[model samples]
Target chain A: MKQSHMAFMESGNFLYTLDRFKEVPVLYKGENIKEALQEKIVSTDSSLSIFPYGPSSGGMVESVYFDILTQGERIQKVSFDAGFKNRSIKLSGLSMGDALLRIERMNGVHSAAYSSMFCHIWEKGIAMDIPDQIKYLRVAMMEAERISSHLFVASRLTGGASQNIAHMNILLLREELLRAIASAFGHRYFFGVNRLGGISRPVNINGFQKKIRQISDEYREIFHTLMDSRVFIDRLDRSAIIKGENSSGPAMRASGIKKDGRNLHRYYEGLEFKTITSDGGDALARFMVRSGEIHESASIIEQALLHSGDLKPDPEVNEGSDSFMAGGFMETPSGDASMIIKVRDGKLESTGFMSPSILNMEAFAGSVSGNTFADFLFGYESLGIWVCEMGDFQ
Target chain B: MKAWILRSFRKGIITSKFPGGRNENASPWSTPPVYRKGDQDPYCPVGAISQGKADANRCISCGLCYPNYEPSMDIHGSVSSVSVPALKKSIRIYQIDVGSCGACNLEIGALANPQYDMARLGISFTNTPRHADALLVSGVLTDNMREPLMRAYEAMAEPRVVFAVGACAISGSLLGKAVSDTLRIDVTVPGCPPDPFTIMDAVQKARGVK
Candidate 1:
């Protein structure tokens, strides 16, 4: 089974592996090759100076340290240290229920994605089948999360370009969506809202589709205005190019790759969410893809709301899985975030998380390299990489 | 520029009358919770409730104690010891992220949106600690961030107000050690990730100290 799991992992496009936690320190024959290469990458010589940006600075939303090796104006390479904010959550030896509380906070903004993915994996392991209404409702909530996340990224992108009006309006739309979500569901960010087999809180998101449509309408105009603005267009165009592979979500789609994990799910079968793509792998392309996805995500929610029934008290998740390991892939707002878990005696033995931000960070480092210092923010914002989600876990 | 000017005028005022009025859009889960009167024994995962009492500083608002404890819908914040009264009119905040789930950071950023409009209260985020009157710290204080966190505080001018913003910072809330273990916090606002209203109320109280 371990060999089969390793074989299964080898068949995929992932670089990081679950083998790291299996007591085998090194997976590949040449383990130090990558580390040695990283050492050479960070080996900045005499002529060039390395500028350290953060650990804590107002320029970033999270505490992340960046070492940008530059020569006068142009950036040569960017190295980041994501260890500053490690919460050191030990998932192993905890009950599945206890492990979940940690996962929800692993990335609070992406709690919908993280919690849903964990529940899905656990359900599959236990051979538990979720009700159709619950699945439909999950789809709606996920899409709502996607919309708000995209709105935020869009706000940051426009704000980076000094397009204050577009930025403010996008924020306004996002606030409206968040309030609507809070009313439709219980929590604003869907916190404590995903149980193992069913939804945590009894929610009625049926009529909320109207509000989703309204916010969609409002965002469309801002989207158009942003596209029409030459200044905004120029700021993003030809910046941070990642010809998206080894990635999952908008970044992958933005790189002209049409793959989305949502397309493979049966719950999203009837929803009219399309996987959008772009020509250039730059910030402009990413912005375009995400802008289009916002509408598609809104449409998915609008349609998914119809299939969802007015959920009553959650079904009792009375069953449990013992001595089992389960893991799978998920398309979070960031990209394709995947996790592998080892369970024994109904407790988590060990867990491996590969958040989309990990892949996006490599792409971001590649994208920002050789570009002028001014392009760094646009590159970072366009990729939608969150350092908070970049931590490697057990 | 002209287009934006006209658009701003057309949009009208959507800002909240917070601090003056109540926060109309506060989320229940993100607000400080209160233990109910009648629950034989409530189980709080974070020890937020003990002996039929709830402590906001330690509550992660995991909702395990729900039906036994619920949100009070108030700002539920307090200025414990001191506040920088000189910053009563205008307070420029420099946010320091020690370590968080990114939720608390976004909630703080949300204050810039049309609904909260924290700028109306003369509150804005500064990119440098030198220009800031207060340091808004969020998340659990990690070992790696201790030096930087302290350096940021040292960089700030005298009469500086420090706000420990979420449950993680207040009591560590099961994630890590509380930030208060390192720094002297003037105000502590609690939630899993305290909503913008709670944060705003805390900020207001810190400035309005007599």
Candidate 2:
């Protein structure tokens, strides 16, 4: 055999080779790529643009740069630039409460998760526990946010498949959730709800409970229609495969990672909750994971709502403290989101946020590579990559 | 096929009745603020208040002012008298995110929801800037986004209108720096992120459509 040299790079568990020919059998770190590969190789090239808009990146944010290489119609390589960086410079030097407000806007889609995680971590660092009722309320709101976030992804997926009806239906369900959130939380996007110690305003427990039950039932019906549609499933299935171990959140769960933050969180430990996973790591798998999680989220909300009576209004627990430092972590709709806070003399000295979007960005190119150009949206939406969240992480 | 049609029928018509008059069912985030004699700046999270009155352009509608001051429905710059005759009737908008939190984008998306189907009113979102008669921009213009935004604006034909969609776009809020200095903002839809109904009202007023 004429020895041909090739190199391989790694993303999660998958080793990707840039070589066009398999006969070469790429090498990695002075070892044969084939010998070390636990999973199959993903070959990619980033040359021609597939989308009419070039890269076709729009979901969760306005723009994300995807450089696609195509041989005729089939995609050879897909690489992405994570767009312009939007640092959280405005957040620095603000009071703890003000910083929290800015953090919610860090990524609008992940606002609730960010605020919840910040409050959780801040309290932990400060050595204070939120009331059980407040914990339940926070869980309910986070779940609601998750439902909406997943629905947004599903809507984009269906819309990309040209299934307008399914797309419209999913969007409607999301809108219903938004309406409920606004009615209960006082803001459609759930901003300013989470504060340093606890929630700013009281939640309408009965109203939220009633709204969720109705919406969840409606969502289940709409989701069934989507799943039953052959076109919808066909568009998503096997198109964008993120290996089992390489991803997180719905993407990870879809690939059989039973890693759910709710499972480990103290608040959700007592709640009747189970992580949903799928063996397939494709777009359909991710879609399925999201759908399954929505049902789980609703169930968790109902369970939490049952104990809504235990909730107390925001207490002045250790408020106006001169010096304190804390960190909190929570699972958002996308994946693990966390925050760190340093307060000096009642003013926020500095704070940091790490959203799931940051980790998921690593897999964006790999997920879309080796797939057809038309299926690009399905892959991108399936991953649920929020650009601003990723950009704000540094 | 029958199942599909039946399911569609069950959903019924859910579009909002805007461009006619105010949507009677539309809920203001808070009742219009009744500016009392007391100082109210400390209560607001976004610093939307100046002197005594609430600046609707900067308000996020968190309702923090309600307990202390009576709410007002008066939205500043809600009325746009500058009628772009070229964009009358059917107008296509291209959305560009300079750097938004995602709320403004969703609010713009809400316009297409069943409650506010902006398409039915002859206003639609276009993927390409070339086809757009107006640019619906959200976000605080970041350094990287400014050039892309300007390029998008230039791609549009003559008589283009720029509709700044939120507090970030209008007044640069907390996240945005000053954006109006670079581009001519024809209309500013204020709110932390304006609701879909308010957005439509501003669009209708700008187009001067019947």
TM-score of chain B of each: 0.92, 0.87
RMSD of each: 8.6, 9.3
Candidate 1 is graded, for docking, as acceptable
lDDT of 2 by residue, A164-211 (tens): 877787788888788777667766777767876777665565578777
Q: Please list the C-alpha lDDT of all candidates, in the order they appear.
A: 0.79, 0.70
lDDT of 1 by residue, B158-204 (tens): 77888898999888987887887777788898887887888888888
TM-score of each: 0.90, 0.87
Off by over 4 Å in 1: A1-47, A319-321, B1-6, B36-38
lDDT of 2 by residue, B34-72 (tens): 575565454777677667777777776565665455435
Candidate 2 error regions (>4 Å)? A1-61, A85-87, A309-318, B24-41, B70-81
Q: Please tell me what DockQ candidate 1 reaches.
A: 0.42
lDDT of 2: 0.70
